[model samples]
Target: MRQYIVLSDAPWRSVPSRTQQLSARFRGEVLYFEPPGASKRSHRDPGRQVRPNVILYTLPSAGLLPVGGGLARPGGWRRQGAFISRAVLRHGFREPLLWTTCPAQVHLLDHLTYRGLVYDCAADWSRLSPRWEGDLAAAADVVFAASPALADHLSPCSGNIALLPNGVNFPMFCRSDLDPPRELRGIRGPVLGWIGSIDERLDLSPLLRTAREHPRWTFLLVGKVLRNPLLAALQALPNVHFAGRRPMVEIPEYVGCFDVCLDLRRKGQDIYEIVPRRVFEYLSTGKPIVTPLYPGQVEAFPDVIYGAHGPEEYSLLCERALEEDPAWVSQRRKDYGAAAAWSRRVEEVQQILGDIGLA
Candidate 1:
């Protein structure tokens, strides 16, 4: 058996389900080391053991701090390096692959030596801090950018950059188009739905204004409220219905209830170019999408109805979607769905690992 260790901030639930699925395919056991409860702070921490054929480090988000946060600490990268160094000292595995979404980890590369490093640029992290991102790009051995535009941005730093856009779990989102569950059945006519955490990244103002403008159209907002102010303001909108967070198994049923879907991401300094995972999930549902226009979005999903960055365009797009034929949009979604499966994306990652002799 080809053994491997997945070093990440624990409570494994925080890690993306796609990453979990990919790890399982490698015929390896995953050991999640929770950051808050990690054995030690520095790389020399004891009680840490590294006995595996391969050690894969999954980096954490740079901006979000740990629970009870005081200045965000380095848990993912630092702990990973500690384990890798220990493995080198004990078993002599000289090179390990550092797979990370955070661009800041690039600076720490000088502190440790590995055979090669793979930067999974899941989002346009450079937007957060351009200078820091440049430093990170210079350090990565291979850059797997989530989109072609992201790859282009990192091209100046690494020649090995590859475009590996986000993929969907077909089975999870693409359920039988049966009626929605009883809880969602009461959501009134011309239902336009949006599902995701109520976070700073969500641009709910446009959705709120749009819902108010068209009183007949009910807007269903799903997912938990991470930020209270945003949730409270959205709840005040008379046409908007807050479904709150439901179980993952029930998401599709909620999505199916929508006559049209919404993927309204706030055009922030961090997320303007990055595509949200929910956009793909909404696409998988074969519902017409009313999304904000951003750089590279036109190329990413040419089929989506691009709304201008304000309430006017958003309201117009929603009205257009409501009037449009569902069958035509549904067909386009099915076409796009086949190409954006998680299985395909994982295979690409495996190929990259094999090329670098990490697989």
Candidate 2:
């Protein structure tokens, strides 16, 4: 079987299911590289493994400040350098194919004279600096975009750009026979849950407003708190419950516990083209989703309850979602399930890779 290395600045657990699914499809080994202390509690350090056929590296977020010398002026760059120095550069791999999930790492590709591909999976390019996009376009042999809008923006730079949207692990998120964990079971009222990093990108104001408007409902947030002050404010609300970040394996249990799932993306120009991972995950759970309507996203997921600006629309949608019969909701979830399967997505990616000679 062919071998591949996935060089990421962080551990695999952050995007576990996606990494595992890709690993299975390529039938290749993964060589993840994280800073010394950044290893996940459950998995082995991927850097310690032997070299593989490909090196997939994730880039730093462009929203971050620029560090000196073209490095992201943030902590991630320092961490990334540690991994690259200790694991990647130190190794002597034979003609490894390079794939970068980060746009920032495109500059680093010049140092590696080998077959390479760049997967610019982020939907936040409109928010990214023009220099970063230019660097990515110049470095990547094949650029995989996350949406059509993103592709349009990148078209001026690379002809090899391909639109590959996000996908979910079907079996994990799909309606399962498994029982819900004890912590999730006792939640008395309708649970409006949102799972993801609580950051500025998230418009929790509307969710909080809706929660306050409908005091009877319980709002559950399952993820790490990024903006502490903002999150603390959200926590101050009586109906909101911040669950912090849960283990990846426990995510499905949390999803299964939701009466309705939320995709509360803050309305921004960058978010217009972004299709969040939670949308597919919510669909897989066979749960109704309440989200803001973006042109690109609505085109992909028309069944979602698209809320216009304001708490009234959001609250009404949540009420409607909560009122739906469990059987009907399950069928809607199945409808979404049929549409966003990873198998189909992987096939699309495989075709893209083959066209670019990366497969």
Candidate 3:
């Protein structure tokens, strides 16, 4: 099996990122590098091995500043170099495939040996530091994008970019045996639900207006909340319920209870690069989805999700969504969800690496 050394800004345990999913399904060994300040707890030298197949390496970043050339600067360079050298040394300096989500990790190219470099980019390059822009333009031998929009955004920087959208853990999110979590037992339906980070991505205007427009419809919002401006409006609405982060296993149960799943992420450039994995999960449950008109979602799932133009259209779409033929929608969603399974995505990655002679 081919071995891969990974570098990502996301902590493995926290969000179960794209890198984490890839590692879990990878046919070979995956070494995941975790720097300080990523998680709440600080890790010492010689990272922790959480799984037999994956290793989490923790080393000091020596205060690697967030801007351009921070990783190459005097203090940052030595620390980053030493950590990568020692980590590679422990593995006898094998020539493993290098995979990273953040372009900033490209600094390791100066210190380690790799058979080939792959950029697993999930967000727009513009959102990253200008320093990494040079690395993105010159360093990676191959690039994998989580959405087609991101692939288009990175196309100018690299000719080898691939459109690899997010995949879902099929059985986990598509549980056929359904029991609504007891926490949601009291909420009366026709439930309109959303599952994802409750942050700036969510447009408050539409949700507020919809809740006010339909007092009888219970609105369920599940996920961690961050930098939200209209938390007050949600709090005031008795019809709106916020279920904080639930265990990964219970996500389907929580989602399955919904009559219609809502994807209310604000429609703008911030969303252009992201194709939420929850869309697949929602499809797995065979529930109708109402979301804003996003280019990424439009590209991947054109007729699958109910795309609305504005707040007023949200209620209208939700009504239409609930009225769709369940038998037809269920079978179609099941087929789509199964086709976009994580295993299929992983196999596609394996094939790509093989085609490039990296696997």
Candidate 4:
């Protein structure tokens, strides 16, 4: 069987990531490695078989050591690298394909041999060191970018970059028979919801203003809320509800309760480049989605989503989205979701790999 060794930046959890989804879909056994920062306590565990053919191993976090060029101190890298090598041999992973999301994880090249290396660039990591990202991109046999902007950003680094935007499990989010989560049952009015990490990257101004303007309409924010200054003001609004974070599987139940799905992200060139994976999930539900008119979003979405700018336009678009969603429109959106499903994305990756003779 084909084998893959994935060095992921995020932990393998109930909330699936691109790395986890793609790896699980590969027609082979996968030895997935979660970096040390994900969890320190799980470092000593042998391995967790998260899927039938995917085993997860967590590396020890070098909390006390200085990390440079993505490697911990000499002892730290040596021990972790040795551990990975042992695991590779135990799994009989000979010349396995290597994949990494983090640029810093490139240091693992010193300890492992792979038939080919794939770099999946899902986020902006140039802040760590552009040189590191450049080096990793240069070494990668292929690079998959999550957005058009990201592809453009990384084009200078690699000639073989391809667009593999974030996607959703279409069947999961499109279930219409799901019962609404208990959190929404008590609420009476129409719910305008935003699901994902509620962090500083979120532009709460438009949402805050809209919430204040329409007290009768419930504004549902379902996700982990980070330290944002406007959160208190939002919490103070009686109509606003924070359902906290829910498992990826349960998100559709929450979406079922939403009258209109809202995408509120902070305005910036950087933020514009990010195509939130939740957007695809939202589309899967065939729900009326109202989002900002970010760069390339209108072209990317075209007929599928409603775009607005600022509070005035955002408020108006929400009204339009609620009123304009007909059966045909909803079906069209669902079609978009079907085309952008994780399964299709995995297939696209495989096709590209085959073309490059890496498969």
The candidate that wins on lDDT is 4
Q: Model 4: what TM-score?
A: 0.92
lDDT of 2 by residue, 252-351 (tens): 8888888889877664744446676778888887788887654434446655545545667878888888887777557676667666677777687677
Task: Rate residue 60 of model 2 by lDDT.
Answer: 30
Instruction: Put down candidate 4 lDDT per residue, 1-359, tens digits, no spaces.
Output: 77899999887778888888899999889999987754567788889799998999988764443333444465666677787888999988898899889877766677777899999999877457677788889899999998888888888989999999988899998888999886578888789999977777678888888888888999998999897878889999999989999887788999989989998776453542667888899999898998877544534686878878667888888888768737758998899899989999989998998899878
Compute the lDDT of residue 81 as modeled in candidate 4: 76
TM-scores for every predicted model: 0.76, 0.76, 0.91, 0.92
In candidate 3, stretches whose alpha carbon ends up further than 4 angstroms from where it belongs are 38-45, 66-72, 266-271, 294-299
**Compared with the true structure, what per-residue lDDT tens digits does model 3 show for residues 1-359?**
67888876666675587778888788888777766666534545456777778878765655545553454465565676677667767776488888877776766677767889888877665655765755664578888887777777677788888878888888887777889898888787699888877776567777788888889999888888786778787789989988988878778888888999987665355555476788888888888988776433454565677777777898888889889988766878877888889899999998998898887
List candidate 2 stretches off by more than 4 Å: 1-11, 14-25, 34-46, 49-93, 123-132, 226-238, 267-272, 294-299, 325-329
Error of 2 at 90 (Å): 8.7
lDDT on C-alpha atoms for all candidate structures: 0.63, 0.64, 0.77, 0.83
- The 10 consecutive residues of candidate 4 with the worst lDDT sum are 62-71
Tens digits of per-residue lDDT, candidate 1, 147-254, equal 666777788887888877777776778776567878766667888988887776676777877877888888888887777445676677788887888887778888
Best by TM-score: 4
What TM-score does model 3 achieve against the real structure? 0.91
lDDT of 2 at 202: 68
Clashing pairs in 3: none
Q: Which residue pairs in candidate 1 have backbone atoms (N, alpha carbon, C) closer than 3 angstroms, thus clashing?
A: 10-34, 95-115
Which residue window of length 10 is worst by lDDT in model 2? 34-43
